[model samples]
Target: MGLLKGIDPILTADLLWVLRAMGHGDRLAIVDCNFPAAQVAKSTVTGKDPIILTVPLPQAVSAICELLPLDYFEESSVFYMAPQDGVAMPPEGNAVIDELKSAIATVSSPDVSIAPVERFQFYEEAKKCFAIVQTLERRPYGNAILVKGVIGPDGKDLKPN
Candidate 1:
């Protein structure tokens, strides 16, 4: 039997496959319900097929973070969609960002910081990711992008098991 801790029940098998298929430096976008995921995903630079999830924004992002190690090579591996109208981060946006930071800290380092990108720029960035998860979150700025990192070896026995 295979058992993995910290795996959220909302992570479906398709989502798991997407995670496993992603390599170091690959990016994953978790967007809100209003995001044009289907249109954007069709044109990513990644040659692989894109995966989209329709759960809540926070749940999808947190669940993905639980299993996906973040890429620390970049200054800020996480990015949020900024409002095109130059508005402030709403309470919901702040809550989602905080939740993502807390979740990333559990699996990786505590210094993970999320940057912001303009609305159109965010869509372009999403077009380069390996996959995009479209959540049911109706909030305007609930989108986020995560870069994947490599997992270390199982042990240092100096031989294969």
Candidate 2:
């Protein structure tokens, strides 16, 4: 029932296995409840059902960051779903986005780029990810994708040559 001391309870054994199985440069999509996760997941590398987490966006991101390193090889390691109308996010959505950003920042390298992708583009990209994780976050556009990075023998993020 219990995992390692610092591990978040939200991270189940199956989720941990997925994370461990992922290689550097693989992608992990963390999507909101409204996201068509089941449909998109079918097209992902894993070609399996999404790992569902009954937690808020920020909480899920924080827990995942504890074990998954963000890819430094890419120009941007994190991508969030952008508004379809190109308008600013609503106050509630912005708040949720802000919290998720903060949570990712706390665990990721300072140089990690967090960018936004168009809604449709995000969906396309999510379909290419290694796996999808559906969270109970209800805020609009609360979807993000993380590029996995490697930890070198020195126990630090592997930098590109």
- Using TM-score, give the best candidate's number: 2
Q: How many steric clashes does model 2 contain?
A: 0
Candidate 1 C-alpha error for residue 23, in Å:
0.8
* lDDT string, candidate 2, 1-161, tens digits: 77688888999887898999999999999999999999999999999999999998889999998899888888999999988775877887788878878998888766778998988899999999999999999999899999999898988878877
Task: Give all candidate RMSDs, comma-separated.
Answer: 5.0, 1.5
Candidate 1 lDDT for residue 31: 86
Give Cα-based local distance difference scores for all models: 0.76, 0.90
Error of 2 at 99 (Å): 1.1
Q: How accurate is candidate 1 locally (lDDT)?
A: 0.76
Give the clash count for each candidate.
0, 0
Residue lDDT tens for model 1, 111-151: 77678888889999999888777788877788899988666
